[model samples]
Target chain A: MLVIRRDLVDAMVAHARRDHPDEACGQIAGPEGSDRPERIIEMENAERSPTFYRFDAAEQLKVYREMQANDEEAVVIYHSHTATEAYPSRTDIKFANEPQAHYVLVSTRDPIEHELRSYRIVDGVVTEEPVKIIES
Target chain B: MAVTVSIPTILRTHTGGEKSVSATGTTLAEIIDDLENNHGGLKARLVKEGALHRFVNVYVNDEDVRFAGGLTAPVKDGDNVTILPAVAGG
Candidate 1:
């Protein structure tokens, strides 16, 4: 299960909505060994395509170094599927190298309603998990 | 030409759970070769058909090697070689 804050969930949804028609990707960082996501680090979608998303290499390095200096790790890696369901695609599973992260998928296919789901993708296997939002 | 190579968590199995390891080489290719000497299965993960795998991002002191020259990028003593699996999807 992934326990996240309400504001964080809202922020992710907003980002997804802002980048509709193109994929949006980012990560949430928390103290090392802490699954609690306390900070959101939005990343540029280098590909900038609706079907693909990649973190810009230089920007990724910068954020990674910052996390290291602050003793934090990415607790959640998230992206939006503008026209698809909130589930990991074959491409998402293929490129998921972070075994310890919660892969959050937000689907904004419907303008009035959004679907959000979380999964654990490890070794080419994806298992959906429950998400509990804590009001803040 | 000693350099520090930082390993991402996913590849730690190749380095016996080591987060960072030292290898000696004047170029990125040579460094990978030296690393393979001690960590047997790593080269296969980072290199494919004699080039850096598209799935991995390698940097020498903050400069991404893809722009520098791929596997032939130069490295010097005390440089940091960081390998990160590209966070990407299609």
Candidate 2:
């Protein structure tokens, strides 16, 4: 299960809404082995396409180095699906390299309501996990 | 040239779980060959049809090898080679 803060969840939803029509992607980092996502690092979608999202190579390198220096790891790797359901696509499952991360998918297909779901994609397998939002 | 190769977590299985390992090569291709000699299965993961796989991002020091020369990017002594899987999806 993904136990995440309410504000972090809101931030991700806002980011998704802001990038509607194009997929938004980012990672939430926390102390190594802590699994508590505390920092939201919004990443530029290099592809900038409605159907695909990729992190800019240089930007990814920088963020990764910063995480290493700070002894943190990406606990939540998220993206939005503007017109699809909140689930991992074939491409998402195939490209998921972080076996330990919670892959969050937000859907903003409906302007009035949004759907958010989390999953674990490891070795080409996708397992949905319940998200427990913490108010504080 | 001796260089330090930082392996990503997904590829640690090929390196006996070693995060960083030393390899000798003047070009990225040569470094990959040397790494294959030691790690065995890494080349298959990083290379495909004689080129670096599209989903794998390789960096020599601070420069992305794709922008430099793909598999032929030059490396010198003490340089850092980082291999990160592309975080991407549809």
Candidate 3:
């Protein structure tokens, strides 16, 4: 049961569209607790794929540190598939470091085909989780 | 009995476009070597100089190999090994 914000999905879709032919990546910051497992604080758009992504390690570390400073945790990590579906690629699953974190994929291959899927990839198993979109 | 390994799109080119393949091994390392033997260059992408690729993640039945024993992770027949690349998207 993974809860995501509707706005976040929309943002991810927009980013995907904007970065067509490339990839869009971001992180989700939120509160951490059993009562409120995940909540989104903000979304970022990687400008370019620095060999792979526009955002570098420094930017990621900054965001992560900021989240920690705010006493928030990175609940979910997101990215877009400019020409692919919202399914976990073999590469995507292999890089599943945060087992507890939800991975949301937004596909912008077809503007009309807006698809957002969430999953929990622990170890190497990809498990589709129900995404509860919260509108704010 | 063989251990089943799932391939990702990025590395499929090395495996002759094979989405999944099966290899025999008692440990993950051996299985990886077997895969590379059948499919050249896959070993480099999966492992570098006998070490797991930094950007690539390996999972055994949905569990991250990082938390497991990594290359030494024990595997058995019918086990599913999924190879996923590290994707950074906003």
Best by lDDT: 2
Query: In model 3, how large is the Cα lDDT of residue B58?
Result: 80
Query: Of 2 and 3, which scores higher on DockQ?
Result: 2
Higher-TM-score candidate among 2 and 3?
A: 2
- List runs of model 1 lying over 4 Å from the truth: none
Q: What are the per-residue Cα lDDT tens digits for candidate 1 across A1-136?
A: 9999999999999999999989999999999998999999999999999999999999999999999999999999999999899999999999999999999999999998999999999899999999999999
The model with the greatest DockQ is 2
lDDT score, candidate 1, position A4? 98
Among residues 3 or more apart in sequence or in different chains, the pairs in candidate 1 whose N, CA or C atoms overlap within 3 Å are none
DockQ of each: 0.89, 0.94, 0.07
Worst 10 residues of 1 chain A by lDDT: A33-42
What DockQ does model 3 achieve?
Answer: 0.07
**How many residue pairs collide in each prediction?**
0, 0, 26
lDDT per residue, candidate 1, B1-90, as tens digits? Answer: 899999999999999999999999999999999999999999999999999999799999999999999999999999999999999986
RMSD after CA superposition, every candidate: 0.6, 0.6, 12.4
